[model samples]
Every structure is written in structure tokens, then in C-alpha cells.
Target chain A: MRHARIIFDGRELDIDIDANDRITTSEGEVLDVALDSDQITWLPPVKEPGTIFALGINYADHATELAFEPPKEPLIFIKHANTLTGHKQVSYRPDGIEYQHYECELVAVIGKSGKNIKREDALDYVAGYTVCNDFAIRDYLENYYRPNLRVKSRDSLLPMGPWIVDTADIPNANALKLTTTVNGKLTQDGSTKDMIFDVPFVIEYLSKVMTLNPGDMICTGTPHGIVDCQPGDTIVCTIEDICSLETRMVSEQEYYGDKY
Target chain B: MTANTLVNSKLVCVALNDKAQLAALDATFNEAPYKKPPTQPVLYYKPRNTWSVDGAEVEWAKDFDGNDVAEMVVGASLGVVIGKETCRVSAEDALNYVAGYTIVGDFSLPEASYYRPDIKGKCLDTSAPVGPEIVAADKIANPDALTVTISVNGELKSTFELGNMERSVAELISIISRIMTLQAGEIIAVGFAGDRVAVAKGDKVEASIEGVGTLTNTLGGA
Candidate 1:
């Protein structure tokens, strides 16, 4: 089963998508809207999502690409709710900055609350999996908390989900293929198997530091191929057997329109 | 500023806002990794799991091997509660968005480096104990001039002035809001100053701001 939340006809709704791509409300009433319809605005699959934990250089190859050594422990950072936007959304590329890139990642949504969770039982706490584009502006990067909020937590920088696919649906989650395309050109390709700290390990590691609650999401880090994105670029991120997330990059001027 | 009011709020905190801290690290800031002093506000997030109410008993941090760690640092500071959705606000208008002020006891395991997000040292469960009550923003004459004091076991351990901050409260809100929209009910924990005192298990810690009430908590035995 796949779950989604959307705003249609000025009404917010909880919906489910079938294997055949049929859309229905939680009450089983069929919705006549297509996933790509301009009539409906998509919200992030999880409503009022909790703390978002993002990994930094969780892939060994990605660490090598950046000329850094693989960390002995997980390099985790927290992103706030303001950074989130849903599929088919517009994200702003700030003016006078260089090297804004998109990172394709798999996001795991926590289903159960647990503290000091063991690695073996970590999967039991996961409700579902979705996809996110962890966008960053390298120009804002500083060594003090290296992927700081200025670089990563800008408004609408993270584009998440068409919807969430149940954990049961992806039996081999660690083996899925993740890819990203910019304006129809494939820019990144990798497998979850390459993650240095896999899903179960991260869940265990985080639970030790603090409680893991329902609606919390962990965005596992991206792979190596990251290319600079520009205004007017359409980036699509997809995880095999999960979902595709689309984002259109626009200038800050276009997004704020003289408001800023 | 009841715990219920902050149940859904996100606690955003700043680092190196204390002028004394920057003065101490002035030479190091010019070296490797940092390369130069921070040009913008350095921010971090304290998630919901770390939230605890005043008078709560917080557990001591444990090592990777599961043994109790000796002491946790006390990050005593003022907390600004946002009353409205704010984005791209100006310094002069920043205070209008504040609903009230309270004390925040940002407890953490002692760690030396500021180069990475210290999730292990700072984000322990029940680490942030906030508020006995909130004093309305209008009641406080000047937020920056307030004096902050830290006490442990009834002994006054440290005292500092909020005016020593590199960035004023209004400036912090204005700069942060420019990058991200701060929702109503969210909090901004203005950073602590100078050398912070550490507390051991069974120790009672109290942090008080001049206008805002004091927040007290105890470290439970491991």
C-alpha cells in the first residue's frame, strides 16, 4: 500500500494509491485526479513530519569523491520542517551563488517509538520508504558544522515524495537502485548497498542518542555524482521500487517576486 | 511557556554568539577547517526528543560502552518564542514576532570540537529543560541587557550579561528568518557565554535570566 496527502479543490485529503495506479481516499472513494494533475497540490507524504535526520557522507564512494576519509561513526545533521516541499514543487536557487546541487536519497519514515533500539529490530520500527532530493548550496558551506543550515536548510530545498511505499513492499531495500536526472540527463546513479551505515545501523545509532518517534524521517545520504544545478533546471530523483520526486528550480526573484 | 505549548515546537539554537567565546577562539578561527571566523550565524537544532520540562530529572549521558559519563555541560541561555509565521523580517521588526521569553537549560555531554554537529554530545534524551513560565515580550524592557546566572546546588557558579552577545536578539531573528520561515510556537535559544560549568549525577542545576523566571532540573543517577 502507498499513502499520500494532497490538497485538492481547496480541501486537504488523505489518499492511497493501488498497484494499478488508481487513486482513492482513505474512505475508499475514488479520486478522479491524476498524479501529475495541476488541479491537485501534493503535500509531503507524512503529515506534520517530526525531526528530519540527514546523513553526511554515508557512502564510501561519495566520501572519496569529495576527497574526505570515511567517518568512523555516522555524520548526522538535523533539518527543520521549513526545508520540505512535495513532489512537482518549485525550489528556489538563490541569486549570486554558485554550485547548488541535488542529492538523491532514500528516506525512511519511523512507525514506532523506541529508545536504545537494536540493529536487528530496527526495521520493525520503520513504517515506509520515500525519496527526497537533498539540495545544497556549496557556496554557503563552512567548516563550523560543515553542512550547516545556510547550505542545506534553505526553504523548499528538500523535495520529498510522490507518496510513501510500505516497508513490506520493498523486501530488499538495501539493494535498490537510486538515480537522479537533470532536464532529462542522468547525472547520478548508485545503489543503497553502497551506504557505509545501512538503514538498520543508523536506526540503532540514532535511537541510542535520542528517542525515535512515529513520523520521524531519516534521509540516508546521497551517492557520488553531484553536478551543479541552475535556474530552470527540472530535476527528477527516483528510487527503484519506490517513487519519483520532481522539482523545478527557479530564481529567488521568481519565487519571492519582489517580496524579499 | 508550559511544556504543552512547546510540545510541537522546534528548538533552533545558535553557536559562538557569545563574544567572549569568539574572543577565546579568535586565533583558532583563522586556522584550518574554520579558515576564518564565521561570517553568518552558526545554527543547530535540538529535536523534540530532547525537550523536557522544568523540575524534570534528566539522565546522565552514557559512553559507547554503556557506562555513565562523568559530567554534562550546562548551556544556560534565554529562549525567544515566536508568535507568528516570520520570513525575511527586519531587525527592527523582529521583536514584534516574539510571543514571550523563557529560560532554557541546554544540557549536554562535554565535547571539545565545534567542527561537526555534536548530536551525541548535545542531543541526548531529556537534555533541554525549558521554562517555569513565560514573561510576555512587552514586559521585558530590554532583552539584551538582562543578566544570566547559573547555579548548582545553591552555589552561584557563573554569571554573564546577555549584552555580551555578538548578535542581538533582534538581529538573530532577522538573519535566521531570512533563510528559513520560523513558524508560530517555534523557539530560538540564544547561545550561552564563556566557559560553561559542568554538572554531575544527582546535582541540581538552575539557570535564570534577569526578566524571565529560573529553570531548574536534576541529573539522575545512572
Candidate 2:
């Protein structure tokens, strides 16, 4: 099942999407809405996600490219609510900064709450998967508190979800193909298999520390092929059949740089 | 709303934001991974599971390895509760966004380094014990000048003033709001100064902030 949260008739509602890509109300009433309907707006599929737990260097190739050794344990960081943006939104790249990039990742949405969950029981806790473009402004990077808020938690930096594909439909998650395209050019291409830490283990590791609550999103780290992205550049991220999240980059001036 | 009916909101903790505390961490973990004193707010989330009210029992969650429950480091802190939608708020106007204040017993397991946060060490369920009451922001004459003290099993451990914080309430709110909109009811746990003592199971812990009120919790489970 694919669920998309959208604004229709001036009110936010969760609509069901058929396998044929048709949108309908949860009550099965057909909605005359398209994913690109100008009359409607998009909201993140998982609204009010408590905390977005993101991984750093979870892909070996990306790790080697950054000249860092693979960490034995997950390098996790928190991305607060302010960073979340829905599909078709614009992420801001501040002026005079260099090396801002888009990272295509698979995000796991937790359904049930559990703590100290076993690795084998991990998948059962996952409600579904969605696509995330964890945009970063690398110019703010400091070795101190690596992957700090300045780098990862900028407003609108994280664009996630058109819909969340139920876990039951994605039985072989490790085999799913993930990719990112910039203005129609393929940039990041990889598979879930390339993850240094796979989904279940990641959940198991997280649950060992904090209780995974419903609506919490665990953004599995991004893959390699990170390149600079700029204003007006449209980026689309996909996790095979799970979902596709498209976002555009706009300069701070274009958004709010001039306001202050 | 009465105290029993008030909803528990998100808890955001400022990490290593005290000048003396950061210097201590800088001296101890002097290595390539970390730069001396973070230039930005190093923050962590203590999710809702960690939220417990005053006088509650903070369970020592059975460790993952099934070993004896590890001792917890009880960090006492002052929390600024947001009362309004704050977005890109200026430091000069940050205090107006605060609705009230409370005392928080920010508990965690000991970790060696601050480079990467250990979820196991900091985010366990029932780890953060907050409040006896939320003193309205305006009621407190000077939020920055108050003293916070901690005691374990009725013995005083440490006491520190909130004025020692490297970043004031307005500055933290201003910097954080620039990154993300801080909604009403959410809390920002200001960094703790002085020392955090290792508390064992069966020990009673009490954290008190002058004017805000005291939060007491007993560690449970062997």
C-alpha cells in the first residue's frame, strides 16, 4: 500500500494510491488529483516525525572517498523537525558557500514502538520505506561534532517522500535499487546491498539505545557520487518501487536571504 | 491546564555548551576527530520515551548484552519551554518565545567521547526526569542567574549557576530557530555546568533549580 499526505479542498488528508498510480481518498473515493496537481500541496508522508536519525559514512565507497575509515558502529546524528520538507519543495543553498550536495537515501518509517529490539525482530517494527534527499551544505563542516546541525539540519535540507511503500510489499529490501538524478542526469546510483549497515541491523542498533517510536524515521545513509547542486537544479531520488522524492534547490536570496 | 493534564513535549538537550565543560572535554578528548570547543550548538534529542515527571522511577533499562544494568550519569539542567511558534527569531526577541521553565534530570550512561553520540548511553527510556512545576518564564526574575544543584541518595554532589552557560537562552533559541522552527510545548534543555555524578540502581536522585522547583527520581531495577 502507498499512502500520500496531500492538501485537497484546502484540508490535509491521507490518500491511498492504487498500484496503477491512481489517487483515492482513504475511504476509496476517487480523488481528481494528480501527483503534480497545481491545485494541491504536498506534505511529508510521515508528518511530525519525532526525530530523524541519520547515518554518516554508512556506505563504504562514500567512506573511502571522504578518506575516513569505516566506523565499527553506526555514526548517527539527529535531524530535527525543521529540516523536513515534502516532495516538490525547494531546499536552500546559502550564498557564497561552496560544495553543497544532495544525498539520495532510503528512509525507514517506524510503525510500532519498541526498545532493545532484536535484529531479527527489527523489520517487523518498520512501517514502510520512503525516499529522502538529505541535502547538505558542506562548507559548514567542522571536525568538531562531525555531521553537526549546521551541515545536516538546515531548514528544508531534507526532502522526503511522495509516499511510503509498505514493508510487506518490499520483502527483499536489500535488493532494492536506489538512485539520484540531477536535472535529468544520473548522479548517484547504488543498491541497498552496498550499505555497510543494512536496515535490520541499523534498527537493532538504534533500539538498543533509544526506544523507536511510531512516526520516527530512520534515514539510512546515502551512497557515493555526491556532487555539487545549485539553485534551479531539480533533484529526484528513488528507492526502486518504494517511492520517489523530487526537490529543487534555490539560493537563500531566492528564498529568504533578502528578507533580513 | 493542571500539572497532571499537561502533555509531555519533545526534549532537546544542548551538549558541551558550557565554557568550562567544553574545555574539560577538549582537554580530555584531544584528538583529530574533534576540534577544540564546537563552533555551533552540539545538540542531541532525548525522545519522548525519556520523558518522566518529578518523583518518577527511572528504570535502568536492561542492557543490550544482558549484563548488569550500567550506572547512569544524572545531568541536571534547566529547560526553556517554547510557548509560541519561533522561526528565525532574533536573539533580542528570543525570550518572548519562552512560555515557562522547568528542572530536568538529564540521565545517561557514561560514554568516553563526544564526537559521536552513543544512543545507548544517552537515549534510553525514562532517562530524562523533568519537572515538579513549570515556573512561568516571566515569573522568574532572572532565568540566567539561577543556581541548579544535584544530589544522589540525599548527599549533595554539585551545584552550578545558569549564568555560567556559554550561550544564553536567547542566543540558543535564536541559533536553533534559524535551523528549524521551534514549536510551542517543545523544550530546549540548556547545557549543565559543574559535574555529573554516576548514579547506581536503587539510588535516589534529586535535581533542583532555584525558583523553578526540584525534580526527584529514584533509579529502579538491578
Candidate 3:
């Protein structure tokens, strides 16, 4: 079942989409929620899931090109709830922006809960997958001592989901393609096939550090060729058949420089 | 943290269940990750009334009974409950420091947080829902690699990673032991992720670690 919690006439309702059914409203309320089409305020696909995490440099080719040794382990970071927004939300391209980038990744939502999960059985715990545009304020911070707060945990930095697509339907997850466009101009176009560390590896590696839970999100890293955008620019991320999460660039009032 | 990078940050011993007092701190602290908190763990003054009991039921305060101020968070965290007092143990010989585990959700004054309000936020009588049991360290193969999840009213709210964390549990004990000595019955929180949401009246929260059982509580607002 493709499960989602959506806003229908302003009420949050639990919904399940079937192979034949795509759109519907809240229980007993005769309403039509536009699912596959252009219309939505994009709230985080799930409400109140435990911690959401992001990985860096999981792709080998991209890592090497950027002069980073393919890490012996996962390079992990956290994204607070304040950073998450749903499809079609306005993503701020802060004032005096040096460079900001969109990382289109296949986010794995944990279905089962476990700690110290072994690599072999990692796939069994994944509930499903969703297309995530892990936007980053690249070069915003002075240096990468650790992904500092303001640059990483900004408002609406992450715009995810048109809707989650279940795991069963996606047989070859690692081989799928991810594309990014800012203002309809193609910038990042890459294949998950290029990833050095695969999905099961990330799950197994991360499980050692923290427990995975139902509704928790694991955002795989972004690909190279990331470019810049400005206000009035719309960034669209497509992962064929999975989702196409879009965000309109907006100017901000106080563009806080990286002090975090 | 390296040599001479240590000092004490004044912390207010605010009660978990008080609201008005906590709202005052929001304008001050910026939520920063404290992996290896300058050698000393995330230690400060614990509320004098803090206690631990298994399967014990909690009662509510009257002022919060009929109003919306009684909800509190279970301070579910990992800290090595010390076995014996040892001063200046080497980084290699720290294993003699075996004691056991304790789950905590004591009173916290995190105002401006979604689930954490003031007096009702951290101070509910039974808000510190602790234990059904405890685990020894020699038994735990890897202490720092564990992840913890917290859920409120059946919704997951906080996620934590112990591995890549800025500091490790053993490192915390070692760092803290350098200045102050480790004593028995003194529990230390390894540290927690800075993000927390709100919980309201009649809401139930469960904090679960992999090996440890769930720490459950029901909020009765002030």
C-alpha cells in the first residue's frame, strides 16, 4: 500500500493509494485531492517521524571527482523537522547567495524498527521509497568542520514527495536515475548506478550508530554538477514514476551567513 | 575537545513541568550538537526531586490537573551508571568502569519546543518514566553505535545516532573523569540530539533504545 498523510479541505487524513486509485479525500468527506497533478502545499509525507538523516559522498565517481576519498564508512548528518517541507513549497534562495545546490536522492523510509541491523537483512526493513531533493547551502558555511546549524537546518531546505512509492514496485532501486532542474534548466543529471556505497550498506552502517524506525528518513547524497538558482526560479527534481518534487525560489529577509 | 578547551556554561535548574520560566530560555540558547562536551559530559545540576522506580505509577499536581500544563517528556538517554569511583584512569584501562544502564526523561526546561512546554512540559510527576530493567556494559558489544528513537502519541519525533556522534559514550566518561571523578549512582547522559517537539495533555510518549525496553509516560498538563 502506498500510504500517505495528506491535507484534504484542511484536515490531515491517513490515505492509501492503490494501483487503480490515485486521488481521493478524507474519510466520509466527498472531496477530490489532486495527487498526481500540479496542486499541493507539500507537508512532510509523514508526520512526526523520528530523526531524519542525510548522507554525504555515497557516490564513488562523484566523491573522486570532488577529491574526497570514498569514505570507509558513511558520512552522516541530521536534518531537523524545521528543515522539511512538502512538494511545491517555497525554498529560499537567500540574499547574497554565493552558491546553493539541490541534491536529488532516493530516500528510504524505514518500515520496521531495529538497532544494529545487519547488512544482509536490511532490505526487509525498508517500508518504501520516495524522491527527495536534499537541498544544501553549498559553500554557505565557511568550512565543513561539521555541517553547521544555520546552513544545514534552515527553513524548508528539504522539499520531498509528491507521494511515496512502495519498495515492492521498485525492483532495481540502485540503478534508477535522478535529475535536477533549476528554473527548467537541466543542471544535475546522474544515475544511482554510480553510487559507491549502496542502500543496504547505508542501512547496515547507520544502524550501528542509531536505530531505524517506521517513518524515519535516510536521504542518500547528491550527485555532482550542482549549479545555482535565484528567486522566481523553480527547482524540479524527477525520479521517473516515483515523484517530481518542485520548489519555487524565494528571496529572504535576513540571509544569515554561516555562523553555526 | 583538546587541551584547555573547557569551561562551565551556567545552566538553569529549571523544573520540567514549569512553563513560564522555561519560555525565558528560548531567546538565549542556540541548539548545538555536543558530542564531546569539553571533557565533562553534558552534566549539570539534576533536579533534587529526581528519582527512579520500576512499574511505579504517577500522580498529577492539581494546578495542572484541570488545565493544559501537565505534559512532560521522558528524558530517555544513554549514560554509564558508574560501578566504582576511579580517578584519572587511562584511555586504555577505562573498562574497569563497568556499571549498568539507566533510562532518563527527567525534568527539562526546553521552552519554545513543540512538545516541551514549561512547568507542565518537564515536571509532570510521572513524566520521568524510567525502567523495567537495566543492562551491563561488558554485555553491550558496542556502546556508542546504538541509535535511539522517541515517539509522542504514537508519532516518531526525535532520531539519534551514537556512532558518528561528535563524542562516544566511553570518551564522555573518560573526558568527564579527567576533571571530576566518577562516583557510584551518579548517572550521566551521553548527550541528546538538540531537536525536540511538543506534547499536549493526555498524550503518551515512548522512548525506545535497541536493547533497552521502552520508557512510557502519559502527560497530565498544568
- Tell me the tens digit of each residue's lDDT in model 3 across B92-178: 666568576645555343434331113223333333444545577667777676776778779989776666455566665665554
RMSD of every prediction: 1.6, 2.4, 18.9
Candidate that scores best on lDDT: 1
Ranking by DockQ: 1, 2, 3
lDDT per residue for candidate 3 within A1-260, as digits (tens), equals: 45566665666776667666565444644335556544445567766554566777778766876687887766666554556777887777656668877788888888887756777888898888887777767654422223443455566677778677788888878887888887778888888888767778878766643346676788888777677777778999987657788887777642222311
The runs of at least 3 residues in candidate 1 whose Cα sits more than 4 Å from the true structure, single-residue gaps closed, are B1-8
Q: Alpha-carbon interface RMSD of model 1?
A: 1.0
Candidate 3 chain A, which ten residues in sequence have the lowest lDDT sum? Answer: A251-260
Q: Compute the lDDT of residue B196 as modeled in candidate 3.
A: 51
Q: Of the pair 1 and 2, which is ahead by TM-score? A: 1
- State which docking tier applies to candidate 3: incorrect
Model 1's alpha-carbon lDDT is: 0.88
Error of 1 at B199 (Å): 0.2
Of 1 and 3, which scores higher on DockQ?
Answer: 1
